[model samples]
Target: MRAQEMWKVSDGTGITVAVIDSGVKDVPGLEGRVLPGVSFMEPPVDHPDQKYPPHDDFDGHGTTMTAAIVGDGSAGGPQGLAPGAKVLPIRTSIGTPMAFAVGGEAAKGVRYAADHGAKIVNLSIGDWYSMDKIRSAVEYAQSKGVLVFVAMGNEGEGNNAANPWAMLPGVLGVGAVDENGDPLPSSSHGQDTDLSQMGGKVLVRCKKNSDWCVQDGGTSVATALASASAALVWSAHPDWTANQVARVLIQTAGAPRDGVKRNDYVGYGIARPSQVLLNHAGDPGAPDVDPLAAPAPAKTPTPGAEQTLEPRAESAAAAGLSWQWPTLGAVVAVCLGLGITVMIKRRRRRR
Candidate 1:
């Protein structure tokens, strides 16, 4: 990514990015960069509008994502792509597998981020059931001139379950790719996928302790990195609207062939913000037009469509971006071992 060159042009200064996921904690690398964040979960009475260490997320996923977006790497710590950006934490989950499985609260968090002055919001969670409330929240954020980046999900099979956020209009659905710029099989595909980015073995600070670091990757990680890339471009062109930033990215992305427009696996192509910032090789197009949506009015889904609550939150593998949904046999084994059935169907959004 010629990160040094990009930094010389812009370090995401004067930009605020909201991380809507598990809670983000106050770590050494993000001393003053973290703003006050709120939790949408109900059980924790004092979690809302907390200063730092907002929620109970022992797994460190949320903190890892935050570090990827805005960590300054203070005192030889892990450095984020957009060090100059500030992070606003929106805790939608409390780190338990059950809490991570819930999907309805994400809509509320998206609206909150837009209202709180976040230029960009990153959603690293995926759910099987597509809800109107979530779609409406996405529309609200877009109308407010906020860019929302959502995870395309991490299911290797082409026949994964449905993801509502990936189907939403006016939001950027992100897929994962390897260091070689090849699409990982785990990265979900769909008409709404806007772009792909490096999500394999990304270096980030561990939430358990800021001093320690880990290599993690998933569609979740890719979404955070894509938001950081937007922070860089938006910081450079502060006057540019969300549509302009997206247009510039789509226009300058690396297509497989010379004239290829888009494909199912990688969408427009790999995100190369350096091409826009350094080479000045993209047109912002129309500020009022959406780069992904059709010119005609979008057809809204009928209320009370076929929807079911999925109960499992899968984890991204350590190597590739793929995640495994426990098979029936595996579930049985787990039940036998634990003496209780989790009864949670993981939402795989590969479709």
Candidate 2:
């Protein structure tokens, strides 16, 4: 990615990305870079003793995601791709047992971030199911000129159902790739995937301890990098609108290996922010023209049905299992496990 070389041109100054996930901790590398955002998860009914503060990370997922975007490499911590950018933490319950119950809360967080001056929103959390509230919130963010990047999910070998968030209009669905630029088998694929980024063997701030850990890779990390890439470009061109920024990213991305415009596996190909930051490549088209076309509307539920939000499965963190990692001196390796999933339950009312 040549993040350091790109930094010589623009280190993402004056850009703010909202991380809507578990929570962001005030760690060494991210000092003075995280904003005091809000939390949507209430005290879990089954676990009232647990409290989720917006700036305090319990599962370590949110903290790692935040560090990947804006960590300044303080105290030997992982250096962020866009160290000059600021992060706005919006805490949700995607990694907790209560994840299935807070779909509306996550939607509310999206609106809160957009209204609070966030230019880009990074959603590393997602589910197999879609909620009307979430769809509405994504639309609202687009209306506010906020660019949203969502993880395409990690079920490539399984069902690989398209994540509703990624399928939403105007949202960039990110996939994962290895150091050699080969697509990771775990990265979900579909028509919704917009771009790919380094997601395998990536180093991130450990959620268990202060030392750095290596993540085997998931779309979550890729989404963070993609979001940071946008921050870098937006910082360099402070006058560019969200649409223009997105257009350049799509235009300058590493071309597909088959020499085609795009593919379901890598979208427009790997995201290379340096193309815009250093080489001055890509054309920022009309500010009002969106590069990604919105998909068709989802089928509406029956008029008198009871709706509820749920998760396809519980996360490893919710099971009280710290993510597994291999130790190498002070550094360790960890698996982010599966992509977070949310499901919606609906019941027909008696006519």
Candidate 3:
């Protein structure tokens, strides 16, 4: 989304997005923008001997995501898509560790965010595990009129299957694209992916030094950008429900493919919130109807399969990953020309 076009209409004021991740620190660009929230990862659980405070960023991931959503460009920092929006920071993990299962805390975070006046929740975190409880939380948030955005994991090296959260029907699974608008190789693809946005070489605040910033790449970053764009659209049309906001986003998104509904690679094309903001180019459809709801039951891939990027068993999920990015100074190093890398983390249990 073009920051210039979006600023001409709305700056995401009066919108509160719940960011469920590591945690958020009070950096210069987001001094007052981050609201106090909860921390699910604590001592004797996910980690030992340390308590993750509500406002502390353990691995700097949450701070980066918070900047993407509502950074004000203060102290010479990069501007976020919704500089005027507020972020509700909630911690669910500590960097790449799988200390506590993501299913339980994730569900609690969603409900807590929705109950605490968060109109949109940004989940820029995921693993290979599938949990039914997570799906129920997504559905509950939708029913309560809150939009949830999840990142398709960065496991493109092996033609990886979609993460269970990304494959959920009610949640909006987001993919990453380079500045030139090509799909990022690490972005996972699947039927549940709803939109694509900036996820590579993105500039965000650093947790080590509040005044400094860093360059990072991942679907985790992409999810925050997409959620920030949603903030812009939702902030502009405050009267619109969750369904209307989602519908308009799908309709106005850029990149048209043969299929109007979904694209395995880019997921209904790149998100252009400006089109919905300035051009009034999207239809908000039925307020009560969920555009992402799955159709009648049909044969589907088995939920559990070999978690690899190579051609998998026919019973495995049919999602693949690809790469591309231009104009970003710090691209993910994993994108070697015609080469692939495999990154894996073990979850306690498979779906």
Candidate 4:
């Protein structure tokens, strides 16, 4: 990707980016790039509970996005835009009900990521969360200078975008466009949309050793790409705040299409980092100003929230995998593979 080429001068070595979503797997491309993360699932407490760690990739969605954002170049997969960046994969929800409990788990996940020292947080998955909970956690991250990125929505259905959490006044909201530069059927339009798309009909690992390359259309993938873009810029300039960086991004957005300028369908335009790298775009205006944080009025809920989650017929549990750890009790359950369990070992309280 051009983003990688532009990152020659900068390395995301010290940048920690947390991916909060379905779960990330231990792909060959990301052996040591990912870190152990938390899971807030409600278990039987005393049962054979999976230690509930993050980065399991039950749906496989998180894995693909993880590769795009932080995968190191080992396998044939494209190297991440921020290859040196550390990915802190966390899980807020999974299964058919990815947005389980109205995003309670998600809010907690963001806080946990920030508390653990993630300079950039990527929410490739989105759902309605408690206003107070999400805003508070996000604000806390911002106060500490954390940059958060989110997907607008998978479908045209407009919802979570209006919320202050995923589509907060100050956070970055990402949208998707096909490789041909046309809007995808699934990308949410209006109000929540952000900019750019990479890898719609892209190759993503299905099971641990398998692969799937379909026209994956959704703001989720776009969100991760945008987050990775920010990571590239922020890693280059560690002194910039969330607002300053965001301002630069919006100000430096590239190549606008005819008949559109800053509309919700495509906020500003497709974000091209090359502009800033090449010095074609001027300085990104006021560093402390947040233009996207317009006085957004309160909004309502999405239709999907009213509907129950539809099972994709594929789950990590059916894959026959078990969670592993260096110790006896720190591993968490993994959810990915061809009905074959791949034990993922995680550790806490480092020895």
Q: Which portions of model 4 miss their true places by more than 4 Å?
A: 44-48, 96-99, 157-165, 207-210, 280-282, 294-351
lDDT of each: 0.66, 0.70, 0.65, 0.56
Candidate achieving the largest TM-score: 2
Candidate with the larger TM-score of 1 and 2 = 2
Q: lDDT tens digits, residues 95-213, model 2?
A: 66667645577788899999998999988876533357877788788888899998887767665554556766677888776656766677777667788777767666564645666
TM-score of each: 0.78, 0.81, 0.78, 0.75
lDDT of 3: 0.65
Any idea what lDDT model 4 has? Answer: 0.56
How many residue pairs clash in all the candidates, one count each?
Answer: 0, 4, 5, 11
Residue lDDT tens for model 1, 9-54: 9989999999877777676677877888787764544554543345
Which parts of model 2 have CA positions greater than 4 angstroms off? 46-51, 205-210, 294-351
Candidate 1 backbone collisions, by pair = none
For candidate 3, the per-residue lDDT at 326 reads 11
Model 3, 88-148: lDDT tens per residue?
9988764535434555677788889989999999887754332556766776787788988
Model 1 global lDDT (CA atoms, 0 to 1)? 0.66
Q: Write the per-residue lDDT of candidate 4 for residues 5-55, one digit (tens) a residue.
A: 466655466788887766776768788888887777545436546555675
What lDDT does model 2 reach?
A: 0.70
